[model samples]
Target: MKVITKILLCFFFTTIFFSVHIKAIEEEQSIIIEVEGDPHKHRQYIEDYHPLIEVVQVYDTIFTGIALKGKASNLERMGSLHFVKKSYPVRTYQTNINRSVPFLTETDDIDTEQMKFTGKGVKVGVIDTGVDYSHPDLSANYKGGYDLVDLDDDPMETLPEQGEPTLHGTHVSGIIAASGNMKGIAPEADLYGYRALGPGGRGTSIQVIAAIEKAVKDGMDVINMSLGNTVNGPDWPTSIAVNHAVDRGVSIVIANGNSGPANWTVGSPATSPKAVSVGASTPPMKIPFLEDSFEDKRIELAPLAGSKPWDLEKEYPLIDGGLGEEELPNARGKVVIMERGIVPFSEKARKAAEAGANALIIYNNEEGILQGSLDDSQGPIDIPVAAVGKKDGQWLMDHVTEGEYWIDTTYQNIQDKIADFSSRGPVTTNWNIKPEIVAPGAAIVSTVPGGYRELQGTSMASPHVAGGLALVKQAHPDWKPEQLKGALLTTALPLKNGKGLYNPIDQGMGRMQPQAAIDTETIIYNPMLAFGKIDKLKDSQTVDVKIENVSKETKTYHFELPQNTHGLSWQLPKSFTLEPGDKKNVSIQLSVISNMMDKGLHQGWITLKAKDTSYQLPYLFINREADYPKAMGLEFALKTFSKEEYEYRIYLPEEAKSVTIDLYDPHSLVFQKTLVTLEDTEAGVIEGTLKKRNITENGEFIANVEVKTTEDKTYNYQTVLSIE
Candidate 1:
């Protein structure tokens, strides 16, 4: 009797231990639970016992899952219950948004009224801050959506009194389906709103994951998430969620990041490998050119912030304010030209304004034309202010001594170029060439809450691709998410900057061409090749790319290798044929001889000339002198604690080599003392303290963070930290 009783007690203790363990895990946080059993059975069980488990969304077909908000302990308990498979805490997500007329041309003028595919029946999900569905441009196609932020059915982007409003979501929605005034890439596509991010343009990861699962469940053809956070690895929760969504026939597009001019800044979701990560590019300047007739030169004119336009018909007397010279006699009712250097542009404009000048022009000391912005608080000038390029301004000073010159402001057709602020890549982990493509992101005009806005960033670029995807989906209704992605990538146009051929690390295939993608009958299966880091220049390194002929007619493609092979070279077949509806894998060999190899990143494209048009595939070979340091440029908003003290966030992907935080006066162009210097610190993120030095006056101050990695690569990121 005693032996039997001991056995029963032992069994009972084991059961209680596991139950307690599972409860502990579930009690930690709210998690989404995926079950392998009948949806009806789980629904009944949830209804019967777990009253706190509020099922936000449910999927029965594509995958059986339930998005619930409950205690982590309870969630773990549910996992052990009948039918439950897994449960994990929800991951956070943030908002990302952007023009783009030339991008429309690149998309084959999809912005035009007569485009064949308008994404009429397709459902595109904008899973971000709730969208302003009431906006005239989006009202027609706003089918309806869910608001995960407020746990409501109406997914509306409501505005707050201060800070970034629902402008991001509204802007992203406009880029995909806005019509009437501000045209979108696919104005006729049906838009499904998902309010994951809240008013401040941020939301927890779980909210975003739930939204993605819900969008897939709702059968969204394409989903655009112009939001992300810096993630170290590809196995991040958001990345996994995106790949899972893609597996279930939903196309996902994400913004690579705005942390640009760097090597590996591609953030999570974009690093998913399945996602179409987009980067920003500058379209033709929207500003007009001013003719310097004396020098026979046409100089581009970028208006100063808070400046007015001048009447072009009248001519004004031009005066030269010597270097660092703003005050001059006979300057009233005349245009003053000041050379850049020795003083801030605002100060120059202020001095010129004080001297009673009619207008002000600051010539650049550097290469390109400078975009000047005068501080409004510095006092109003009541006259127009503009910037001129270095070369033209120098010529103006040398040629026109004294004369009443009439400046002609005429428009010019300039080619699109990569935006300097747009993030670059060689993605940190796999070096898999981020920013699969570039789009017009600078000065992009789109819808806001009450009116329209012209915003810039990778945030703006992602929507262009998202809108393009809707068009591609409408054209090929049966194409899978991967197929749609491959079509857009393979058919893109190769981009080159002022510096010459842009590396594959800078642009994946190139800027996207949606019109060509829709009309093309053939496509490449592989997105791009990332020959990560080859220590030695072997005889040859080869990768296989599968080509598919989706058309009814057999197609022949002739291979063309890059002419200027610096160190890398490819051996391609003279020609290849793909029968209708057939797929063939071609082995392209990339060889690098010992003498030709370089230390830094080596990148280029392999072009395939088809009968009608050509397709290009990008490849990267990174042979760094030293192992590249892992670093992430943080995105943070400054919060003021007091007049002297302010708090800024330091969110790092990995420990920094050293970080220096400093404050600068924009009006005076004075660099204050370095607030803090951290060396060999190992913290993922922190609310760092910054104290202002000699801040006698109260206004806005610019806080800059300079991060130097172990590899000597420096990342300079800044934000406006003000004392209100």
Candidate 2:
């Protein structure tokens, strides 16, 4: 009896110790892990040994990979397995919904109304956060696809409560195949949705690879991945997988990323040499307005994330809420105007709601209108709230000397320019020109899960190319992926920010002219020219570019270099002609203006002028000897303006002796010439304010902040500002 009791006690203590000691992983996270040799074999190996790890999806054709779900401890053990090549946490992508509808391509003259083809029979795969397969605009053309996220047949978008649902997949699909009144670039193309990303717009690279392998196996003609992470290299697993897919005859178009205006920000997969990485561009002319009884002020209004739209027709007394809770007595039944800074936007809106206000307006204390969100807290906001540019908000506060001043809200058409937030590049390390093409991305309207909505980012831009590529493929079905990419690159239009040519880094090969791409007979084989880095001033390099004549007729071409922009000198062929189906390789030699250039990115364009068309091929080389920030290293943010006085926080690695700040009108792109220079700056967060100016107009502008060290090296940081 004593021996039996001791045995039972030992068993009980062991069970209790393990239950208490071992951390219970209640919520399992998904991951994609690559394996040596074959993923199927490796998966079998995991099932045999790492029994706790769940193998969800496996890829064998394009690459050996598997999707997994398991506890943190089990996942770590699985990663350590002998057969595992690599394991990465699944990441989510966020939808950058900032705009509304499909006029983007019309501006490029790629009108489907006049086109002979609408991507009929072309199978395009969208590897994203799944699509709303039943969206009326997309259903007719949806050919069905796989959902890697749920391991199901129906690839539908699912939104999580705590996460912001990315309507990205649906939006991208619409760009490729939406029909009816809102026509896509490829209005008749067949779309397959591969739901790799979950509702939160997040997915692992391996899952994406699995999707690519599936799409390739399913015989997809084109794959659109408007998703990426900041890997900035072509050797990443997803990039290798994408390259494999391309080799298997599928054209892949990826978003260059939305981390733009900065150099070397092009993310992975898009970093793949064969992929058509896209960027975003805005229209040239836009008219922003706020409806008012006195005058409809042309102002840039930033809407809060969860704030309901105001009832524009209703009129109510507008009261200033800057005096805080103590002044709530005067804000009853009115639209309370609160100054931003001390309290959070949600808190301010809540206070206004508590004060019995009908609506809320949070004005900036600095230069621009603020983009606030009432989403940080749970539950619905009771009042309609909006943010206005600082200048306009202040003018309203000062001009309303009488009672019951009410401002009405209305939406208007805004111009297309490079969105300040759009990702820029010379891909990292390689310094290759990225964002091979730009498309309308800002305020773009497309299909959401249930209906249509506007989302911004390179995500929107890539689908435009995907849809456009469908048209291209339909036009030249015999062309390979690179050839189609070549045609588009050579036929694209150059976009400028009003001041000067937008650096190639900001807008690669410029915007896409889809019609021109379809009509072009000649193609440049080397779409991107990366001179790499010229560490020494005297270094000279040579590269050969191949051009092909795709048309039945013979074509003549002459290559010319744009007058040396960055101390770059180039040799171009005087003239060359290609017979039908003929290919020609031309050698070009490049040398730096060695003595003339300071340490920075030096670039130039080589234009191939054909009989009826011309193509711009951009080339860039960096100087590393010169002390310059790694483009992404410099960070800064502008504060809301109070009157003409505004401030900014600039972060840098090296200590700065002085800072030279310049302002430019984003519309004009012209330097304002008024320099706000600061001296004796420290190494860390350097803050300074712009003195009050006589500026009264409300619009968007750019701050060209420059930091200089005692060594005379200069680094620049650019940011956008709104005058409310």
Predicted candidate 1 versus true structure: per-residue lDDT over 280-356, tens digit per residue: 77666655576756657787666664465543445666778866453577778787888888887767777777788
82-138: candidate 2 lDDT, tens digit per residue: 776533322233342223223434435444443677899999999998888788888
Please give the CA lDDT of all the candidate structures.
0.69, 0.70
Task: List residue ranges in candidate 1 displaced over 4 A.
Answer: 1-94, 97-114, 161-164, 231-233, 283-285, 288-412, 498-500, 537-540, 564-569, 593-596, 624-629, 633-724
Candidate whose TM-score is highest: 2
| Residue 615 lDDT in candidate 1 | 75
In model 1, what is the error at residue 642, expressed in angstroms? 28
